[model samples]
Target: MSGEPEPGLVPEHQRPRHDECESVLLTVDGEQFRVCAQAGRPGAYDFDWLSGPHEYGFGLTNSGGLALSRDELVQAIREFLAEIDPATGYLAE
Candidate 1:
């Protein structure tokens, strides 16, 4: 419950094999959770960590430059993953 993905839980596949850009990737507990807009600007993605709950969400811009620091992204992804509960499908709810 203290920010970690469930041990031995196989992460769900969170990506489409053939996306046409405009995608966001949420990394929670070492797993990739992604959502995307097929018609939006391709690969314009960003993420934010949800504190206290250990969850994160990603968004993709229609058309904009990518501006995410690697350190921040990594931290956010880890925190997001830690928030997920394989049994409940949420932040330890």
Candidate 2:
């Protein structure tokens, strides 16, 4: 094979930059969230609540790693949503 990744494989150097990464907007139970690939870390993702008062709510107290599969990410979002306080749109202390 040539100096290239196999046809079905993605090479690390060819990964998209942070700004170029595609973000997904999800509305779960009327709460909006944005999920996108984390910068400098391939296959890793970062997420934030678009309708929450806290900008760093997801990161502030979350101990989960950024690297997660699509399904895992969705599960994490659900878990995060469960922790939110409907009255304030912030995680429960």
Candidate 3:
């Protein structure tokens, strides 16, 4: 795959975390975080792993969450990343 990154997906490190596929992979601490777009009904899409890693595994606990709008993507990512506690699987206040 090409190393070029996508617009919405952000890359961590120099690696091509973001690919042509509208998805992003980030590594925080020793944890690997990934989010991808899932197709919904016609003319609709939702992001998987919106809540980020909650159980300290590869994927986040919140897989099939509400579909976020374009404007909300960045804020949602920030909120989820800030709230998730990898070890405890609990969101910080």
Candidate 4:
């Protein structure tokens, strides 16, 4: 899907004003996922993943309070996807 965020996944009014926000589309096992991160207060990141009508998200912070690189985010997404239960399409408990 050109690896671009789907139009309207994030509303314009809710988007961060800064240019630090980054987003991309990824497909895994034929499922399309939208991943996004915005630099938050103190340089940490608020990130989320959206697939169809479901979304999972969290904040991320480190001692250094640096933003995660795109590659790093992608790796993290892969790990997150690995934990999803195929039967329910949600993270396994």
What are the RMSDs of all candidates, in order?
A: 10.1, 12.4, 12.0, 8.1
Candidate 2 positional error at 56, Å: 4.3
Better of 2 and 3 by TM-score: 2
Better of 1 and 3 by TM-score: 1
Question: What TM value does model 2 have?
Answer: 0.56
Those runs of model 4 whose alpha carbons end farther than 4 Å from true positions after fitting are: 1-34
Predicted structure with the largest TM-score when compared to the true one: 2
lDDT of each: 0.43, 0.54, 0.38, 0.51
Is 2 or 4 the stronger prediction by lDDT? 2
Who is ahead in TM-score, 2 or 4? 2
TM, every model? 0.35, 0.56, 0.32, 0.53
- lDDT: worst 10-residue window of model 4: 1-10
In model 4, state the lDDT of residue 4.
Answer: 18
Q: What tens digits encode model 1's per-residue C-alpha lDDT throughout 1-93?
A: 122222222223532243554445555454565444334344344343333233445443333444444444455456545655757555555
Off by over 4 Å in 2: 1-18, 54-56, 59-67
Residue clash pairs of candidate 1: 22-42, 22-43, 28-80, 28-81, 29-81
Clashes of 4: 0
Top candidate when judged by lDDT against the true structure: 2
Please provide the root mean square deviation of candidate 1 (C-alpha atoms, Å).
10.1
